[model samples]
Target: MKTSNGRKLSHAALSLTVLGALLGAAPDSHALGTQGACQDNHIPVALAPGLPADQEVFARLCLPPGQTPATVQLLIHGITYSHLHWDFPDPTGHTQRYSYVSAALDAGFATLAMDRIGSGKSSHPPGATVSIDSNAYVVHQVVQALRAGQVAGPSGAVGFQKVVLVGHSYGSFTSWYEASDYRDVDGVILSGVSHTIQLTSPLRVLVPLYPAALDPAFFGQGYDLTYMTTQPGTRYGAFYAPGQADPAVVALDERTKGTVTDTEFSPFAVILARPLDIRVPVLLVNGAEDRIFCGPTLSGTVCSSAEALIAAEKPRLGAQVPCVEAFVLPGAGHDLNTILDAQQWFAVAQSWMTRRIGAGADQTPGCGP
Candidate 1:
């Protein structure tokens, strides 16, 4: 009868912009292709789909250098991408040419990348439940698995050092949840979540205002259709492409429509209540032209918590930004891997992680203006 997917206007705008703006905003467009030379630093680990179900998932571990460190940095992946997404060829999978994982390895830091669980090699958890909480548990188990030698991590640090979880989008939610779940973490990094989180109206409610053309073009042919009839979890993650859902991972978009209350959920919002309780520094990273959050450069900030983090090329509406060190990479979109020299961003990230993990300080403490 009616289309349920909302953001029809924004979707139409972004669909048109995806070709020229999203891909063209960067100066290093050529580097996005294979010609850019993707360098693999070093991530020695195996893939585990998931526990109980025994699905195949992807993960890579980087051992600490000569000296055993005391802390570890866990890199949480964003929506739709596997653990490999942020490392090499970029998390966005926009291109294999630029991989942040490669840069992290080259920088000589201990890190781990994990496939959420079901979307990758891992089997789906029972009840087909893919909630953010479930993803956090998966990350928790994965960390244990890493320590157990099922996956690898910083050597020497062992059980002594703090574990910092860096998350993006849904991945950030996992990290946010991790901060509350685990006690050993040293810090958490949130990018793309400048501030508060607001839930969108359910598809069932939005269908009346549905824009047919926008659905196929925006969500792509297969996913939009599936979501239209099959319901969300049929493919699991609707945040990005279906079937690519990391069984071990979950996003706000994953659960049943309106099942979780906004107060009950929201990674950034979760961080606020326990901001002082966390006792860890948080770094927030975002793109000046982030289409998804900012509504294709549309008015209003991508997130509600714009006050806490330091703003880069935008205005803050009295949010608590000073607490969050915000950085904006010019011209970058949601594509973490394909953005810029990919390696450079990773190098920068490595610096941040290194500083937090006792490797060193971020050469550039500030992000963008």
Candidate 2:
């Protein structure tokens, strides 16, 4: 089966079954061990200046065991993903191998994984109503709620002394927008994204997208044809580096892939152009073979290594951010969290958070070999 863009669509039905299987598995037993509680919450927040009316954002707060954590990590997923991306369930039941939430829990940090307004279980408004600025406002409100202890958890109202915003891909862009304007977060960790789009055109060619309404999976949920989604079987090609991601993980991704609003893509340049005026520590993590951001497709540029990729983005962040660090995960692609060595990236992020934001476990040099 081929779409209008000529991309083949195979194994979509099989992928959907794979998704069901993964979702059917019980939540990780380690998600809330003796150390802390993981509470699912729906937070109502008003949209930002240029967006639509208020909506409820769905989030799961993972509290540290025993004592209240002074700092919390607020997680945001990118295009075509939800909170599930943060704590991906391994079909094989390997807790330590497949989950970033597990890694963070082991490191003794609280995590609040959220689904953006238009994605996941969060309220699905019109596609035009979601943008980077508006999503940033939603995140800012969530941060305020965390600080004020206004968000109601299962145990009770929950709050944190410090908050760090962690985002992947489009989520990273939203994080940059939040830290730039609100400056409320203690630290920011951006994964699966960068300032450059060297091969964006090629990526567009490869991942041919169609209307969400056209997809049989999401036809009648109030999403119009304007909401775009990648054709079946394209995710692995676009997101996973060659021979890097596990076959099972890739199958799960195809099954659970979400949608991207046209509004979100149109205003992306405006969002990316804005300078991040964050005064807190910032970390940028990208896959070494990321096709969109750091691949060898830029007409006149060379970004063949992780250091070169990070160097391209450093100057764009501006000098206001106090400390900035970058790590490129070897043999990974755009979806760093789902790759085989995702735990290693999580360790690196935890280390950075501990050193900069005073959250998580003691610092360990987890980036390099």
Clash tally for model 1: 45
Put down candidate 2 lDDT per residue, 149-240, tens digits, no spaces. Answer: 97655467767878889999889989988988988877889887776776463445335787878887687888876688888888877777
TM-score of each: 0.54, 0.85
Q: Report lDDT (Cα) of residue 336, candidate 1.
A: 43
TM-score, cand. 1 vs. native: 0.54
Clashes of each: 45, 2
- Once superposed on the true structure, which residue ranges of model 2 sit more than 4 Å away at CA? 1-36, 49-53, 295-306, 360-369
The regions of model 1 sitting more than 4 angstroms off are 1-57, 64-70, 90-97, 147-160, 196-277, 295-308, 311-323, 360-369
Residue-wise C-alpha lDDT for candidate 1, range 7-68, written one tens digit per residue: 11122333343233334331121122121122111222222234353334445444433543
Which has the greatest TM-score? 2
- Model 2 scores worst on lDDT over the 10 consecutive residues at 1-10
